[model samples]
Target: MFVLDLIPAPTLRDVADILFLTFVTYQLYVWFRETRALRVLIGLLVLGAIYSLAKMWGFFLTTRVFQILWQVLLILLLILFQSEIRQVLEKVSPLRFLRTRKRSFHGAFVKSLIRTVFELADEKTGALIVLVRNDNPDEFIHSGHTIMALPESSLIKTIFSRHTPAHDGAIILSQDYITQMGCVLPLSEKKGIPEQYGTRHRAAVGISEKTDAVCIVVSEERSEVSTVTAGEIKTWEEPEHLAKQLKDWLGITESPSVKPKEYLKLAFVKNWGAKLGALAMVSVAWLILASQQEVKIDMIAQVKHVNIPAELILGPHSAKSVSLTLSGSRNSIKALKAQGVGVYVDLERLSSGTHQILLSAKNIDLPLGISVNNVRPKSIRINLEPLKKKVR
Candidate 1:
């Protein structure tokens, strides 16, 4: 009998959250790839890495640049990925990315691709067909007709046919189905686009830039079958090779066939990867949560035997920079909100042996999110003696 060890296992809830967030990140990847902003993203990532290194090594300037750029980047990202962001949200009508996207056979998807290529090459029908990958093509599909799913060969041939309704626009995909025809995709906005690039070629590059999807275009003017990925297009003629390429990209080609024992090892490793990723995410989440918590601390003015009065409490002393030393909780190390607590001691009134004063603060209940572990100086102790007379 084999007994499974659950020791050191991470919680399932954390795992699920990790996977869901991972899937969302994947979808975002597809959305961001191959676009103008993709280069910027890479540059930013590189800069971030450099900043991390600089901080480790004490290169203050590099760290400053990285920190400063972040201030402007948020606005720029929104502007650059405007269309793509909208397209992705539209595709996730019901938030499917919150869980795993189960793979189903996108049948007829390949056949249609093959047929379209053959016809476009033979008859020189300028056409583009886009396969939605990690991102959604809904925004692009809005410009065309939403049809019931159709067989690939028939759909491709008809779309390229001279008399067909969608001959001018691109075909769009969703969930392994041919969901739309004659879809209007954003045109390539790069200034260096070829002089001869017509609507079809531009659309192909445009969609490829904006999404991780594979786009196939048959150039009517050249009788060429070109594939576009990450905003770059490449041409080819071999149908068999193309089929193999599709399968490989979609991961149907030669998946590692491991033995049961090997499979167990792989699965465990995969789960470990997932757990590690989750822990990283959890750390970030914890920081965000801790920041937002009502966790607060109050600084205590380290004083002895001096009774603080109402006047000092209401106003500041002659020294603009007051040196206060007090403690309430761990949060006190960096922050002590005025509303959380306040104290003022009458520095002149002290001729003391020992004195006790009640400590008070507003909302000592700690706003909402943080718990106070320890209160420093539960009683202020003052050791007092009679004031000595000054010699004339």
Candidate 2:
């Protein structure tokens, strides 16, 4: 039997809980990446490492201080990055009206959007398109004209034309429909915005920082295409690459044309560093936490009668098993439970009607790192009877 069988099997609810937690963690990592909160998260992990080490080394004072800090760490983080937390919560909230929608032609919409963006880039016409997701960007909608029209490449290009009246503002897209056009967005008040970035870039970053919307901008001066999401902006030179990124951000899956190996290679080459770093961090954290956790378990071990003479017939014994309490690290205890431990009694030299055999820690064979702390019925009484001679 596997070691896991020593414990109760996980239910469907447990699987669901694990999957939910994994999804949330991935989302949080994506949101925190390229943001100031990344540094805070690293610092917290460092503190956790220190606490684990202190606990393993039995440093009471240091461990106590870290434990106290851990108790208030959540509140402290909330107070320190209240704005960033609010933004993330708003993006993940289900109550946002922008997320309530029926399924439509997502593939066609993504293709049209990509085609329109590249067309505007080639013509040197500037465009800012905001793709709203969970968060409602309705506050900025009143500042512009509401189109509520189907998404099409030609229509998008005409709306963003240099001579058009709506060319100066942004167009808001909800799924496959154009919700609004000529919408003036909130400009980012964040300091240190580069002088090269015009008002459009700042506005794109502003809306992205406040919501979960993906913003695409085509620069009029350089005809460069850029995407802004989660307060970070990345410039793309190739139209295909830009299109692929937009499809990914919008969760639009393309036809399965690429081979599995080629897709894996591309994924690895894209973000291997981040993926490896996350794996290493999780491994180290698990090690530290596991090493510091101690557990005590009470188990009943059978007593084995060994080295008994053939002439002796064993009679009833006061106790056939002993209760043992073992203490060690959780891993060690689990292994011991899986493998099982037992106590032995030597009756080769005993020829008694009633005799008590004293049991101690030495009587039981235990695995390394595990120690017996308590044993019930420290001694056992054995009653032996001699075998009768057989008549010929």
Candidate 3:
């Protein structure tokens, strides 16, 4: 209860602030969840927590060092995570939220894609094919010939034929079209990738890591088919299984194996720890950074006289204004105003003689969570004089 009392009652603005912060934090978690950058984010948060604890515990040297290092660390992080930062900003854009028709692979296109992959796999012809998703890989694709042709097996095979010049590079498949062929892709330098995987496989993993695109790699050495999505690689032994996987990835909806409840469960329960941690981190940070600070501000409020006898008039010697020293949370202090506060002096029972009236919290009308630490002129002398009869 004591802790609760210290917490100021939340206003509409406070609620909105929490809601917006919670949303941004959750979105950040969603964006970085699949990448190694998420671990880096967790590390940054750990550093922040340490800094906050150092400050709270009055470790002056530790706090001072962290304070000095924060600016440098911020710039370093911007340089290190520029790509992740750009992707996050793109996701949050207002225009990105505007509804648009979702693109899906047609049955014919899917069949052609599967046929092309198997044909290349059988002939031991190495090929890399990129399936574009919501995130365009145009920035990563270079030196590709613009084909803009339908995703027909004959055209794809012809482009990937061993003797063809473009067969050395990758082809990009967008909605219903082969947008580009012979495009060079960035290679993944990630450790622990199998030694058996060659340049084509590395390129597949590279593009998948950089964007939301699914990559298919047909190995010339093993004559096997492999798929990379979100930096994870999977191999399919049977063409039927690969076809099903492709259909699922393309949202073709051959059959609904999972229920809607399962999807809800996946959304909420998949990374439950990360989600809860994000919420808690934002809420705690808000308390530490926004609400818990103590501040003192001086306000001058008018001294109001109440219950004075009708025959008695206040003398000029009495104080007309009081300077109040108020202490409270930063928000409370910020919201306070001189006009909203009042110092009242009751003169109902007092006689006409000069009386020293002690000014205290009871004499002041103050908002909640605010206290008058000190008042200039703790006691004001009031002299009530009898009014003389008015001459007619």
Best by TM-score: 3
lDDT, each prediction:
0.61, 0.78, 0.82
Q: In terms of lDDT, which candidate is strongest?
A: 3
TM-score of 3: 0.66
TM-score of each: 0.46, 0.56, 0.66
The better-scoring model by TM-score among 2 and 3 is 3
lDDT of 3 at 56: 68
Model 1 misplacement above 4 A: 1-82, 87-116, 131-139, 142-158, 161-166, 172-180, 188-197, 208-213, 229-232, 249-392
Q: Give the clashing residue pairs of candidate 3, or none.
A: none
Tell me which residue pairs clash in candidate 2. none
Please give, for residues 326-362, the per-residue lDDT of candidate 2 as tens digits. 9987767877887888898888998857888999998
Runs in model 3 with CA error above 4 Å?
1-27, 33-36, 58-65, 102-106, 161-163, 188-198, 244-248, 251-263, 279-291, 294-325, 329-352, 355-392
Rank by lDDT (best first): 3, 2, 1
lDDT of 1 at 145: 82
User: Model 1 TM-score?
Assistant: 0.46
lDDT of 1 by residue, 227-278 (tens): 8887776777888778777765554555556799988887557647545554
